[model samples]
Target: MAYLYYGADARPAEIPDHVLAHVKVVAATKLRRGESFMLTWRHRGEGTGGRTSLWMQPSIPLRFVFDEPEPEALDSEYLRKLANEATSSRGIVLEWDDEAIVGHPGEAPPIDAMAA
Candidate 1:
């Protein structure tokens, strides 16, 4: 699991390491270009039963903590899809998906292709 800490609030949003990794890339790209967006996610655990959205900007302090020692390979197609969602009216939504860690919406290349 990974945690994304923003602002002075002690409670950080917990996400999977792989998801957070992709989010980091997408967010950094947007922030670098001075774009702000809302990031929405369903709150898990006791006492937090609903969804929450945060306004992400370049000015806010953000921190990402990952439990994994090494970073995973990024899927460009997945990143593009995420970025598109973030810019849309619905905004970016983070969800828990075990399959997303390896293969996402786009087709995953064959093992032989990866070796090339």
Candidate 2:
């Protein structure tokens, strides 16, 4: 598991290491370009019926912590899909998948899924 610490909030958002890795790349890219977007995701299990969203911007302090000792290689296709979704008005929604942490845009799976 991984956690994303945003702002001064002590409770970090829990995420899978692979998922956090991909989100870190996409978020970094957008923040570097001075773009802001919303990152939405449904809560795991049945407790929270509503989804949560974070307003990501360049000014906010963000940290990514991974449980694994080494960082995973990024998938370009998956990153592209995330970036594309971030640019949309509705913003990006993080979804969990068994095959890959980050879901592909279309019918095709990520080209480098096995590498990650």
- Best of the candidates, TM-score: 2
TM-score: model 2 vs. ground truth: 0.82
lDDT value, residue 29 of candidate 2? 78
Measured on C-alpha atoms, candidate 1 has an lDDT of 0.76
lDDT of each: 0.76, 0.79
lDDT of 2 at 21: 83
TM-score of each: 0.81, 0.82
Query: Model 1 residue 68 lDDT?
Result: 82
Give a tens-digit lDDT track for model 1, residues 1-116: 89999988889888888678778887887887899888988876668788889999999999999988877566666677678877888878887654454336654432211111
Clashing pairs in 1: none
TM-score, cand. 1 vs. native? 0.81
Model 1 spans > 4 angstroms off: 46-48, 97-103, 106-116
Question: Which candidate comes out best when scored by lDDT?
Answer: 2
